[model samples]
Target: MYVFSAQRRAISIICIYMTYPYTTWQNCVYSIDRR
Candidate 1:
């Protein structure tokens, strides 16, 4: 049970972090595309 909970916590953190970096990357791509 402990292991399962720990894994869920790690995945949720990574998912949020993934979104942060991905948005930055998308903005960079969009700016270059507009030019």
Candidate 2:
């Protein structure tokens, strides 16, 4: 059970790291469009 939980946590962390850059880039595009 501990290993499963740890694996789940790692997957979530990886997902967040993967998406962070995409969200940041999207926000930058939105800001540029506002200009």
TM-score for each candidate, following the candidate numbering: 0.41, 0.42
Candidate 1 regions with alpha-carbon error over 4 angstroms:
1-4, 21-35
TM value for model 2? 0.42
Between which residue pairs do clashes occur in model 2?
A: none
**CA lDDT of each prediction against the hidden true structure:** 0.54, 0.54
Candidate 2 positional error at 13, Å: 0.3
For model 1, the run of ten residues with the poorest summed lDDT? 24-33
> Cα miss at 20, model 1 (Å)?
3.5
Question: By how many angstroms RMSD does model 1 differ from the true structure?
Answer: 12.6
Local error of candidate 1 at 24, Å?
A: 15
Best by TM-score: 2
